[model samples]
Target: MTTQDWWRGAVIYQVYPRSYADTNGDGVGDLPGIIAKLDHIASLGVDAIWISPFFKSPMDDFGYDISDYRDVDPLFGSLADFDILLARAHELGLKVMIDQVLSHTSAQHDWFLQSRESRTNDKSDWYVWADANQDGTPPNNWLSIFGGGAWQWEPRRQQYYLHNFLASQPDLNFHNPDVQQAVLDNVEFWLAKGVDGLRLDAINFCFHDAQLRDNPAKPVEARQGRGFSEDNPYAFQYHYYNNTQPENLPFLERLRALMDRYPGTAALGEISSEDSLATMAEYTQEGRLHMGYSFELLTNDYSAGYIRSTVETLEARVSEGWPCWSVSNHDVVRVATRWAQGEPSDAQCKMLTAMVCSLRGSVCLYQGEELGLPEAEIPFEQLQDPYGIAFWPNFKGRDGCRTPMPWQSEGEHAGFSDASPWLPIPESHRARAVSQQDRAADSVLNSFRQFMNWRKTQPTLMGGSIQFLDAPEPVLLFVREQGDERLLCGFNLGDKPVSLNIEQLGSAHTVLSDHGLREAQREGNVLAFPPYGIFFARLA
Candidate 1:
């Protein structure tokens, strides 16, 4: 693919900076450490690497709460180290996409500090500040995703400020032209640094209702988990007024205009709204976000019908815009554990990778997903994620998926860090380490690499129109066609064996096979797939 369309149908590997690798032995991963692992990332046959936030922060919400937008955190490394990482990644033919948390910033950020000082300050209106009600309560009944009321009282301004996430992460007033310009300027700074693209965090939250209207309460059945469960009270409201404002469209156009100045660059937005699919469609329309993804697939729903409906809905809604899909990421439970009805298996991991990669548009494969890593159980005392600490037992937060990537099978902290890792590495994860998988031909890691490389050669699979075939419950069949090529992909999305007729699927020839078990052999035109089996064929 050319530079202009390189991100189209691309596979971008997501690397959570804190857990990827550590070079300084500070028990935390850094930019230099990422540079050290560039070769391994390239070996996966991915087009780009989306590194999570490494910006200067107080770590209240990890690196999501940025104190300095233009500089790298000391914990990650200096700006020079980041430049080296960009250079090395480009040398390996991997586009580097950095995180851009545009919706909010740490309360400690200079802008927030100045804005919170007094209403007369130049930056006073840069953040969402509102007056308290006559009853000395918040201006509205909006709630934070992290729990409790979304408003935080500021003594200096004698007003309440909105915080959709952690209180430390105060929402920015995107309605202010200056704030939008400043955000664009910060993005321009990275583009000037020769970065390839940006992963826009909470892009939907960029704009909020100007009137500060109270969000209506959501019915119990209408609620869906964005970050927290229904028990957190965050899911109790419709969230219509607080976010997903119509004004977000024009601001995205402004952001896209900035991106256009830097040729070959792309923007992949992370959207979480009540109608996330609809928002994704709107944000990715021409002249807005280039690609967009949501938490629809990351949820615990694993049925074939559910997956088909989700993709079909997005495909219908998103006309000119492209879609990016991810089954696992830093925020949710690993797919290996979430989708598995019982113990996770290597076959299930390989199948999941194949399924997501086969979809239209691009893909974001989370770090450690290649090894079929399950969520690591973190003890309450060892939990580092503040979200986890606040809601334990029912919702253990994101620490389970944020555990350090295991590099070596036998070593202190599994070779992620010389010192203790930020989060404890599960002993079970050691068995699936890169070192161990590198030597095994049938390992999940090897299968992922093979499948990814194989996908690159299939134009039909890369950028094809998908059509779901009518199949039984446990089996999902889809035909992806591009130009003259048509490839049919079938997956046994269950633990039990399934049987179907190849003739019924049309005249097709098996082109690829992974290490999936087949209890009964294919008889005549009949095909039998064992648990988590994957089959790829080309239609004649």
Candidate 2:
């Protein structure tokens, strides 16, 4: 495929910076560390690498609360190091995409500092600030995603500043044309630096209800578990007024227009909304975003029906727009453990990988996913995630999934650091380290490589029409067809064996299997699948 079309249905690997690699021995992963590991990432046959935020920050949200948009954080390294990393990634034939947190900024950000200093400052209107109500409470009843009221009283301005997430990370008023322009300038800065694309953080939270109205509470019946904890009062309201407002569409158009100026640059937005799937479809429709993904598959629902219904719903809703799919990321529990019934198994990991790649969208593979790593069981004492600390055993936050990438088996801290690592490297992770898997041909890492390499050879798998097949529960069956070529992809998401009639599917050649299990003989018409088996075939 041409470089321009590289991300179309491509697999983009996500690397969480603080846990990916720590080169300077400061217990934190840096750009130099990422630069040192580009070869290993490229060897996976992924089309691109989407590194999470490494911009200058207070790290209240671990680089998501950006203090500076133009330069790399001192903790990560300098702009020169970033340039070196970008050059190394391009040399390895990998496209580089950076996370852009445009919706909010650290309270320490110069703009925010100025905005919060006084009411009459030139940048006072840059952030979302409003006067307190007569009762001396917040403007409205909006709750922060992190915790507490979304508005924080500013003593200097005698008003409250809006924060959709953590109070330290104040929301930018995209309603202000200047704020939009400044954020776009940041985008231009990265594009000028030769970055391939951006994974826009909380893209839908760019705008809010102008009237500062209270959001209506979601009825108890409608409040089925949607990933956020009930402890986080943010889940109580429908979130109609705070985010995903209709006004956000024009800003997306403007952002897309800026990205269009830079050739081969794409935008994959991260949309978290009450109706995320519907919003994902809306965001990627026409001139808005190139593509967007939601928390649909990121949740704990591992059933075949849930996966099928989510994709089918998207396909039906979004005809003109493309979709990007991911089973796990930094925010959710690792799929290995989330889907694991008893003890974690490599077979289940391989099945999950196959299932994600088989879906009809561009894929995003998180760091350590190739190793089939389960969520690290972090002790409370070692936990750095405030969210985890707040919820304790109930949720465990996201620190478990954000632990350091295990590079070696025998070394201290899994060789992720010569010094103490930022987050504790789980003892369980050491067994699946890269060094151990590098020597084994049948390792989960090798299986990932094989599946991805094989996937690249098929145009149908790359970008094709998906047709859900009539299959039993726990067995996801679909056909990916492009022009004259068609492939039958079947996955057994359960431990029990399942069977389907391959003669009914016509004569076909078995092409790939994660278990290395050959297709069973077609006894008249039925073809059987063993536990956790995956089968890929092309019609004869």
Candidate 3:
């Protein structure tokens, strides 16, 4: 791939800055710490790094609530530190993509501060402000993802402002042309700073229904939508009027236009709507987002059929855009724990990585995923996420997945920090630390490195069109072809072994190893798979 298209089918490593590494003994990771750890990230053989939010924020949503778009948060170092980090990453042949939370701003932001002070203020219309009913209720019945109503009562303006997320993270009014221009200006700041691309946070939530219509109620049996579970009241409604509005497309085009001005810089949007897959298709078509991904794979559904149907559904809807697939991120439970029938095994975890990477798009591998880190069990007393606090034991929020990375087996707090880390590093993770894995040749971390390095040698695996083959339960089969090169890929997602007859090969195939995965024994049309086994064959 050329410099301009480097993101196409690229393996992007996601680094949640708060959990990556802490250099200032402040119990939090920073830009300087990420810079210090660039060598380790580069060793993983990923094409780029996608750093989570580190911009100036109140840390209300753990840096997602941006108070200043152009400056780095004091908790995560300054602008100078970021520039140094960016330069160091480039020197190590790693592209840098930072998170851009454009849909909302911190309640403390100057724009919101001024807008909330008085109705006649210059920035009054900068946010979504609407009048309440005669009974003094909210303008609409939209519920916040965190909990409660999406509308917050601003006493100064005597009106409710929309906030699809937390009340502190008020949604920006894209209806205002000035707000649109201002958002683009903030995005241009980083692009001008020589950063490679942006991971747009909730890009579809930029515009709301101008009519302020109420969302339709979902049936009681309906459990989830827009990545929220039944535990969240936000899932009770269809969320039609509050987000994924048609007006957002023009705004995306405007954002795309800015990114085009800076060559080699792309936009990877994070989408979640009523129908996230369909929204991803619409958002990335034409001159909009460069690539898009939804939370379908991030959910707890782990099966061969579910995975196949999800990708095929998106592939059918998408015409001119690319998709980015990820099984693990900073949200929900880790893949090692979520997909495991019981206790997760190293072999199963490695197979999971290989499985997701084999899909037909770019991949986002979250930090600590290489070590097959299971989700840490965060006690209620130790929980920091407000969303988690609101949901409690029934639905433990994202704090479990947001714990600090384990860097060493013997060091205090796994060498993540000298002080007590923000979230406790699970004791189980110490055994899977980077230090321990570096010495073990058969470690999950080592297998990850080996497979990624090998994947680079196969052009078909990188950017090839995918065709999933029909197979039995716990077995995902597919064919990836680019030009004359065709490779048959299969994964046993279950814990136990199984034997199946796959006549799809027609016996004209070569069993290819060297991906450092468990092997599959073949006899004529019968192939036997071990626990979490992988099969790759070069088809003639």
| Residue 398 in candidate 2, Cα distance off native in Å | 0.8
Q: lDDT tens string, model 2, 328-400?
A: 8999889899889788888778778878988888988899999999998889999888888878888788998
Residue-pair clashes, model 3: 0
Name the weakest run of 10 consecutive residues (lDDT summed) in model 1.
513-522
Could you give me the TM-score of model 3 versus the true structure? 0.98
Model 3 alpha-carbon drift over 4 Å, by segment:
507-515
- The TM-score, computed over Cα atoms with residue i paired to residue i, of candidate 2 is 0.97
With a 3 Å backbone cut-off (N, CA, C), the pairs that clash in candidate 1 are none
Error of 2 at 453 (Å): 0.7
Ranking by TM-score: 3, 1, 2
TM of each candidate vs. truth: 0.98, 0.97, 0.98
Cα lDDT computed for each candidate against the true fold: 0.90, 0.87, 0.91
Q: Which stretches in model 1 have alpha-carbon errors above 4 Å?
A: 502-504, 514-524
Weakest 10 consecutive residues of candidate 3 by summed lDDT: 507-516
Per-residue lDDT of 1-540 in model 1, one digit per residue for the tens?
566989999999999999999999999999898999999999989999999999999999999999999999999999999999999999999999999999999999999989988999999899999999999999999998988999999999999999999999999999999999999999999999998999999999988899989899888887778656658898889889999999999999999999999999999999999988999999999999999989989887899999999999999999999999999999999999999979997888888888899888899999999889999999999999888899887899899999999999998789899998889999999999999999998888888888888888888887789999888888888899988888988888988889987664456677775533222345667778888877887887
Q: Judged by TM-score, which candidate is best?
A: 3
Q: Candidate 2 at residue 316, lDDT?
A: 89
lDDT of 3 at 117: 96
